[model samples]
Target: MTRSRATLALATTAASAAFLAPALPASAAVTKGLQDQEMTVNQPGLTPAFLTAAQEANVGLVRFNTRWDGQASAPDPAQVAAIKAFATKAAAAGIGSIEVSPNISGDASFNPRGKGRGPKATDKISQDAYRAYIRALATALKDVPVARFYSAINEPNWFRHIPQRGGAILYRRLHNIAYEEIKAVDPAAKVLFGELLPYARPTSKSYPHGQSADPGAFVREALGLTKSWKGRGRTASYAVKADGVSLHTYDFQADPSRKSSKRGRDAWVHANLDWAKADLRKAARTKRLPSAAAKRIYLTEFAYKTSGSDKLSTSKASSYLKKAWTVAKKQKVRSFLWYQLRDPTSTDELWQSGLQTRDGGVRSTWTTFKGLR
Candidate 1:
């Protein structure tokens, strides 16, 4: 369908109409589960072996980071080949859903183009490229059964990203394009919004003030959180555009010292997550839908890294995972997808959020997580 036609269909979902946001039955379908996929390395074309592992883990969703430039720039034969293979396996395993990001600034292609954050970017090419890229990618994956949900950006509100692009405009347009096209392809499918990074205000007195967690700030900005914050132009008007919302939690990032102690770590996880849950629900209520509509948050990307010189111990990792699951259940969250399936590369320590190590071997946390009901 043409872009204009697609938008016309979604635009029909006016604020006055009480539309039923249709979705697949959660009963026969899989319940909310962890995501185990990363960007650092390419797996062997989504092999049967990997499918077996994901199925064994009983995960309902296998999340993949769909980078717009990475795949579309060269359309890497191997990478495209892997995505097709992965989709097939996920369908067979009943673990379906692909969450994608358009503005992957850190990647070699976009990062060099410019620097700064939020929705209003100084780089014209980078910004325009990102929008066109997402539209193209969304069109490509529109037919994949396993590709159910689409998140416009990875984490735009995060300090590392936001300061470069600006926050409000980035998400508003991204979501506008994604929601319009995704629904056009399959109106029954669910499009999740705001995969916010979960972090709390730093407790350290050394760090300066005015910096809050990325997700919180994004919401505050997106919904016009404050009276003084001037909004970017309204390229796309906001409505209850998405079926669900998304958030990513990793408490370890909040601590300046990066301590692995039990008390310190647990506090970080709880406080940050609690803040996220409350903020998301509030945003959804005010900006998304009626106060009674079933607005939900999907913890799509979350994990504790323990592979550095002083990573969390295996026992500690397991404990953290358990506690996270507990909190997720308590929060009445829609679903929780862990950060990764396997650490596909060793190039960066941050890439080690997977349940398996660099070599594809399972971690104790993986074993513990696989047993979750």
Candidate 2:
């Protein structure tokens, strides 16, 4: 999910109104029309423009990543300052919530070859360091008025991020640690399990790097691990401790509107959500993991590349975006965040999925997104 470099860029409440609103039924609590974007807030020139567009689209939520490796031992003063600035700016812009996922680059000492894709594989921060970093981050951002949501890591199922012998186990441990540490500092904040990249099949032929864990099998295994912890007298299963599950639905090599029947490793776009939800339900059936079934699904990253060989025409992209929202609504997803606000570069095929051109001009799909209810 790496992209070309570009330039950079909450609010709180009415906190009482949100906290005091009679709690809606679980189904009702699921945010049906809220839309968000996954943007690199640290990019210069980018954040301001993205914020303007978000306000125009009536988007209230924004998701971004903060690298734990960058702040593992001690808080990075610059990064912390940037975060604060971004939060302040966002709140003034009428944004309501900011979801930040800490990117955990694996421990190099444990795996010399490194785990994860590209630079992520070279991240050497230890588990304890990761815990310390998130705690520090949560404490630093606690005073910010905007609702804060924290996802422990980004895409654990991606091989380059967790390439060790027991990647899934390692991920579960990391997520639990983050959840505990974040809550200890900001109890009101919501902690989400790291988002999973939806793969149509359980495994891929792109060996080594791409033979990542199947999202379905990975969740089941992760939940089973959490369930076992309960039997060992842990206070609560990790499966149920986290607020929600995050997933990316980027229908690679297939049309977003097409349904996929294949299971375990299919990359079909439309079927990924259904398969993921079903997998969660199935995992929860194991008596030890019953609560897993109740978590809300957050589609945190989704987009269609517009310049790649598999690129969809701008008109087609609009149609797909519409359908994506329709499916998300039907699935009762808590949030539907598109991959990005602006393309990183006009030439990078992989990063051209943004609703706007590289220079921040609107694309055909921008109207489609703005029209989303």
Predicted structure with the largest lDDT when compared to the true one? 2
Predictions in order: lDDT:
0.51, 0.60
Q: Which regions of candidate 2 fall more than 4 Å away from where they truly are? A: 2-40, 105-125, 200-209, 225-240, 261-270, 287-293, 346-349
> What are the models' TM-scores?
0.72, 0.79
Q: What is the per-residue lDDT of model 1 for residues 33-58, given as tens digits with 9 covering 90 to 100?
A: 54443321253443565667667876
**Stretch of 10 with least lDDT, candidate 2:** 11-20
The per-prediction tally of clashing pairs is 23, 21
Count backbone overlaps in model 1: 23
Error of 2 at 135 (Å): 0.6
Per-residue lDDT of candidate 2, residues 1-373 (tens digit): 3322111211111111111111112453333222222232345345677767877776766676665443355455555555666666665456677677765443433333323343332244367777788788788877777777777777777554565355666678787888799899899788777477676233333333444556665665565533222223332453446777777777744555567554344342455677567656554555434454235777777787767665788888888888888888877877778776676553633456778877778888898988788
